[model samples]
Target: MQDCHILITRPEPENTLSCERIVTHGWTAVPLPMLDIAPIEDAQQRAAIRSQIFDIDTFQYVIFVSKNAARLAADWLDTCWPMLPVGVHWIGIGQGTTQALLEAGIPAISNPGHTTEALLEWLKPAKMKDQKILIIRGLGGRPELGDKLEERGAKVHYLSLYERKKPHYTAQTFFMLPDIHLIWVTSGEGLHHLSEYATQHKPEWKTLPILTPSSRVNQQAKEMGWIHASCADGADDNSLIKATEFHIGKQHD
Candidate 1:
């Protein structure tokens, strides 16, 4: 069988990681970075971020929403605090986020599952009625986590550590992949960005089989006119690769 050409739409570092794993299966992995994540570089904004990092002890619990959040928040903390704040509990939402925290020398706790909803469910045992919670993430993300915590009587504060920008790709982007067999998207936002890039050039993309990291994104893909989107259950390389092999085999059969 010929190697399947699969497009990986994650940001770099992560994109590279996923591609490395995908190629081990003898599939051609294409690196098409959808989001560019970078720390907030504005002088005033930098100062504000540093202040929030330094004062994390004020919050009862601090949550890192993504690997980028944990990494950038740790970078800011490395500048000021010789020692991490003692009483502030560090939490990460997913395995990748937890691993990033651990790599940055921050001790963090993670639940079995990934997602804001899972984190909230795991934190049910931890009383937060009168406590302050801090959530660290990229700029302009969903307010669901904070809003849910607020509903439970916790005062939630957000520390914007970085920004996730969609990389500009011409409509000709999709045309360049002449032999592309499949596309894997980890998030709804990535699917949206990819769709926008394909708009002017391809107009319709319902025939191509798409692999999504989760059912939520799978539904989003279907809602946006994708007729053959399959959920891989998770974004890690194993899940995506397994789903790809299965879907490709099913197509041939």
Candidate 2:
């Protein structure tokens, strides 16, 4: 555990949290963000999301699909509403998203299961008919959550707040071998970029352990020829820490 350097590929703030936790364990945290988060550059789209945020009080419920959405949406909400509108329910897909909401002064319902199916299952008890539900997310994701809600006769709206883009970098931008003991990426896109960066730095280092947030990402890592692809099962801090410790221990063993 001593002197271990974990390569964190998540974006700012989130990666910063990982760094704080890792250093406490006497491990070095190396942040090399692969994806950059930003507001939608299209003026019309940006205006639409902002308009929705302004009219947030009209919605019966607001569901944030990811931490990025929760963070961005919270900022907009903070600016738009001095006092959060009552009678509006807030929900987050995972503990991380819920934590982000809480940090932004929004008390959101959270669950251990971070997937869309899990969210749908949890909402089974509620009567979704005639409910105005707003979904906050980044660009280009599975439509399952929105689709299911709409199918249940709930009016679903998407307030895509940001875009996850790759950061252009040079070979000199990364630390390899001795400095990076393991790689941890929450998204498959991050894992893909990690592979490219690692290969560019030192192709042989692909043998190093890489942890993913889900089984889908683990499978993708394996397909990309990663030998030590490990799934963390969840995206929350505790899940990530436990998975990191388990994988790092397994590697040492």
Candidate 3:
């Protein structure tokens, strides 16, 4: 993997972690961000958030869906909660999100694994029944987690903190492909966004090897004509690194 160039599709700021890990493998990390997180500006959504600012304590559990969600929740908490509240359980969907909460000085936090399914399994219906839960997430994500929680008799609420947007490229992004050896797709949305960008501009870039965080994303890459693709068994940094190492090892072997 020495001198290998790895491209990261996650948005800026948050993409730093993946970049750092790739560099640790002695690979050049290229950040061609596929998505940028922006706050939702809808007047109705903003007004609703403002109105419910005080009701934050009513929820028994606050779930941070991603590291971005944790950062947003930390910002909102600075204005609303100020000091950390007791008795409210904070659940981070993955290790990255859990670490984000820890960095924010949030003491009581739990993360089952790195995916929604793991989190849902950790939250058994018997334990969650009748409990009030607030899910802090970005603009668009799967509703399965929320739907399942509600079906189990929990009252679920969503506080969408941001939206993922495509970045405007200055030069042709396709020209940057030759130097890229491996690419990490953090989410299916990021993969789709990158695919859309290539479709309109640089169809040649689709041949690069891509590492996905989930099977759904890996399938999306296959449909997009990616010649080489791999999916991490789990979404944590360790699993992602393991997947990348395995692929690179296989290539050299």
Candidate 4:
């Protein structure tokens, strides 16, 4: 594991923490954020998000799609609902998001798994008929979660708090490409951008093992010609580290 280098595609701040964790396990972690997250700058959009938070109790479930969503939404929530809304269940899509919610003083948060599909599975057994669900996420992403919730007889709304864009990579960033033995893509967008960039700049690096938190990402990676792509148990740092170690062990065996 010491000789293996893992490329982390999570955005900054988060990537720093991931690197520290990977270093503790004796594996070199490379920070190569494929997507950058920025708070929504438009005043209209900010007002819209605040409006949703003002009427937060109207929805039965408030689902945060990722850690960024949870953290960003909580920032607004702190101002709007100091007392916390009643009868509204909070749902974090994964462990990291769940932790963010807990840290924000949101109690009894329901976290199904790392992926949206897992949340759907957990919600399938519930009585969601006519229930309102508010999904907090970035500017644009897959509509699968909202679509599935609507299909289950729930009215779904969105509060887009942040926007994700492709990061600009410099020439020096490409220098680390050769040493990246394993790639950690945390989102579908990250995987797409990383694959597209590598296809144009570092095609040979695509053969390296890629570990993702969801089957959806793994499938997309395979479709993009990343045959070594694998799915970890979840999207947290520990899951990624364990997956990387397991893959390295397999190479030795």
Runs in model 2 with CA error above 4 Å? 41-43, 175-178, 251-253
lDDT of 2 by residue, 131-151 (tens): 999988889866889999999
Inter-residue clash pairs, candidate 3: none
TM per candidate: 0.91, 0.89, 0.90, 0.95
TM-score head-to-head 1 vs 2, winner: 1
Model 2 steric clash pairs: none
TM-score of 2: 0.89
Q: Is candidate 1 or candidate 3 better by TM-score?
A: 1
Each candidate's number of clashing pairs is: 0, 0, 0, 0
- Scanning candidate 4 in windows of ten residues, the lowest lDDT window is 106-115
Q: Where does model 4 exceed 4 Å of error?
A: 176-178
Q: How many pairs of residues in model 3 come into backbone collision? A: 0
lDDT for each candidate structure: 0.83, 0.83, 0.80, 0.86
TM-score leaderboard ranking? 4, 1, 3, 2
Candidate No. with top TM-score: 4
Please identify which of the two predictions, 2 or 3, would achieve the higher TM-score against the true structure. Answer: 3
Model 1 lDDT at residue 129: 83
Look at candidate 1 and tell me the lDDT of residue 231.
87
